[model samples]
Target chain A: MIEVRLFATLRQGREKSIMLDSKDFSTPGDILKHLDIIPGEVSILLVNGFHKTLDEKLEDGDVVALFPPVGGG
Target chain B: MERRYERNIPALSDQECRLLRSKRVAVIGCGGIGGYLIELLARIGVGYIRTVDGDVFEESNFNRQLLSEQPLMGRPKAKAAEARVQRINPRIEVEPVSAYLDKNTAAEIVSGCDLVLDGLDNIAARRILAAACSEAGVPYIHGAISGWVAQVGISMPGDGLIDILYPQGVSFRDRSVLSFAPSLCASVQAALAVKMLIGRPVETGTIYYFDLLNQEFETIRLDLGKKE
Candidate 1:
């Protein structure tokens, strides 16, 4: 299963988490495409505590989190 | 002779002032709070400043950003801040880089600095900076402002301070709403940075919060051992 999470404004507009079967997806880009999340809308992506770029592949049961850039100071 | 920092000069001797003049500081973000911090540090004669920001001045920045204005809109914030600081005090050295603070560049940028200052808008960047500081063994002053409240803290190496203070993660909000917040927090941060640079004693690994609405301030000791 692929578990996707959202934080901050992204969470406001979408469900915090989404679950998908591992055999149904190949990479994070594919999962994002399936979710219909527009590319570049979210700035940072973390896969299991490590920052990931757009092209990085996903693994089974991986926890992926997305965050939109929000100003704090 | 050129003008000196009258207040800080008297409090800290000439030798200490020279010491401050020889140190390097890197301020990440270059927004409302970062702008104020850059101005203060340059005015007081910090020898080297490395300013980082991947953002440009926008129409919304005019409300509180010291370096933001109608003419400067659409320009790189780091470059504009560097120009403004140079004009304020040409004696100090300023290097402004227009780029995001990521893992690749964080270590190189923060490695030589005596200290790092948080002026970033997002928690992710703060976490990245915190991690870089931890790796580099450099001291970092953290500040965040939201609406009418502001918070400041100093993190030392091996302290695990950021993880303790913001365990769940910091909330990411719109920049415009945090205008007054950064100024208030940056003012205190600038003072603390100067104190740290001059070898003065200051509260470390502790969080300080201020509420502008009620005009009250409070300090809290964090127990980073417990994480959520």
Candidate 2:
């Protein structure tokens, strides 16, 4: 299973963590679509603790963290 | 060594105090987080401070900006920071740029500075400042707030933490911050700056994320190739 974690504004009205079968999602963009999150709304998308593009392939047991933009002084 | 910083002793040694006095820092943006950061650094006796902000205090800034007052409204934010620094510690040297840092001016603003602090509100300005600091080989402490959450981190030279955190050409949703969010975040940034200046061990290339409302704090280590 792939573990998805959300932070900051991304957690609003949504579970902080969601689990999905590894075979069900192919890329971060696929997971975002399944979660009903727009690609443009995400600012940081990390897979297994490193920066990865939306189209990067995912593997089982990978930990994905998503954070929305929080730009303010 | 003076009576003003007497309370900082034990927490900070006498040698560290002297080191702080000899170091110079540049704070970009003079609203919200910038206002409190300037005041804290002044009280801590950072000898030289260069404040760069082209914006002025408006009525709306009173909710969170410490330097924003009825009398100071319509005045340049950097000038207000300088005055506040002087009022807190007269011996500290303060330079008010009174101008926003752009591509052409970012490098010059960070030049000759031991450290740079981010108090910018927009992604575009942060990208410019972070690139300038990277080019100048200076360490930058970044802080940002939105409502009850904030993130603070130190970007050493080429980490490109800003770029990693904020993707290029991305549109960020406009979020309003509460009055206490900036103050809380600025204090954390100031503490980190003090630790770095005093030769204390501060973990770099990692972002400290805070959720004040839920009392949850987490540190996310960036894979910047410098982590031990």
Candidate 3:
């Protein structure tokens, strides 16, 4: 299974973490599509500590986090 | 000599003052933090400054924005900040761009700066700026304030420390619950920018939070070794 995490403002909308079965897909885009997140709404994506483009593939046990843009100051 | 920067000349030697006069800095926002930062940098003899902000002064800003006033109500923040900086130090050059900093323009503005200070209020712009700095191999000083609490950090390329600390899309909603917090954060950010300009080694990649209500300060070192 792959782990998907949401942070910051995005956490306000949904569960913080979600587990996806490994057999469902092979990349981060698959999970994003499965979850039905709008493309532009998710500004930054991190997989395994590195910024990843939407096309990047996901592996089992991968931790993917999504965040929207937030301004506080 | 015009006797410009006489006040700062004593605190920083003539040679160091020259360094300040020769450096160029890019400040991304001209609100609370950016307004104070631009004023400090200009007064201290920072050679050149590029200010960006697509916002204007609203009635809400009069409380904490030093540059905001009734006379300047509804004026573009960039222009107001530019005017104030010029009033403080006419010898320095100030370029005020009234626009938002996005991916396409971030590189162009940030590429030439010796240091980048985070004066923005939102995370999206912050992340874009951070990515641009990393790609350009420049050092970035970041600060955020929300409701009596403020956070500051310095990030270098390849460190991925901010990624761990903020962890992409994680929004601390409580950050905007109060107004005074950004003022405190801006003050700290201004000090950090000054420290960076004078060739000092800043304690980078650590988050420092200040709680004004409780008068508490806490430092959290992000686990740089952590991976997704």
Candidate 4:
């Protein structure tokens, strides 16, 4: 199973988190695709608390968090 | 200090408050965060403040830039910030430099200052300031805001936190910051700078992510490896 967490405004319109079967997705990109989240909407991704590209593979039980761009001021 | 800082006790010892009277702090950017930081530092008795900004106020800045007022629009940001300091405390010295801070001039702008506070609006400019601070061995306080989200971090030489967080050439586009966000983050920046001035040790390379919309906060550790 892979755990996906969302933060900030992203969490506002979606569930705080979701768990998926590893067989359903092989990478963070795939998980976003499966969740119907547009790739362009995310600005950063942390796989188990470190920066990682969306194409990086996700192992069973990996934790993936996504955040949208939030630059201002 | 003076009898003015009597009420600052408990939060600050008399010695600490007095020490603040002898320190100088450089504020890069006289917009929302810089304006508030300059005011806060002045009120807290920081002896000297160097405010840097070349841009004048525009009507659109009224929504979030604290120093921007109807009458002050079209005036230079550093000038308005200096006026704010004067109105708040006649005793504090404010050196307002009405110019854009870039790689070529960052060092000279911040020279002789104990610390540099970044109230800049964009990432590329921040990178330039950070490099300058690192070269000079002065601590740099950073704050950024977007909507209800804000991040504050300290960059000491090797952290390289800014570069890790904002890649080169990437910047905020059409992003909007609610009025309160920059204000809150500015307060945080001022507090941290004060803490550093008072001889308190500060941790660098970690960001405090604040979500005011949901009233939540998180810490993100940034270890982009040591700087070259």
**Per-residue accuracy of model 2 over B1-228 as CA lDDT, tens digit each:** 798989989888999999999999999998989988998899888999999899998998988998999999899999989888888888899989988899989988999999999999988989999899999999999999888888899999888788778876565675688888898889999999999888889998788888777777877777775322
Candidate 4 is graded, for docking, as acceptable
TM-scores across all candidates?
0.73, 0.94, 0.72, 0.89
How well does chain B match by TM-score in each candidate?
A: 0.92, 0.96, 0.90, 0.94
Worst 10 residues of 3 chain B by lDDT: B168-177
Across B30-140, the per-residue lDDT of candidate 1 in tens digits comes to 987899899888877788999999999998877778889888889999999889888887778888989999988899878789999999877777788999998999999
Top lDDT prediction, candidate number: 2
Over A1-73, each residue of candidate 3 has an lDDT whose tens digit, in order, gives 8888865445555787988897886877787788777654564566765566677777888888775433466
What fraction of the reference structure's interface contacts does model 1 contain? Answer: 0.34
Full-model lDDT, candidate 1: 0.77
Error of 2 at A27 (Å): 2.0
lDDT of 1 at B131: 94
Q: Return the TM-score for candidate 1, rounded to 2 decimals.
A: 0.73
Off by over 4 Å in 1: A1-71, B169-178, B225-228
Q: Which candidate is the best by TM-score?
A: 2
As for model 2, its CA RMSD to the true structure in angstroms is 2.1
User: Fnat of candidate 2, please?
Assistant: 0.64
Worst 10 residues of 4 chain B by lDDT: B165-174
Over B1-228, each residue of candidate 4 has an lDDT whose tens digit, in order, gives: 367788899799988988998999999998877878887898889999999999999987988888888998789999888888889887889999999989889989889999999888887788899899988888899888888888888888756777666755444543778889888998988889999999987777677788888888877765557331
For model 2, the superposed segments whose C-alpha errors exceed 4 Å read B225-228
Each model's chain A TM-score: 0.82, 0.94, 0.82, 0.90
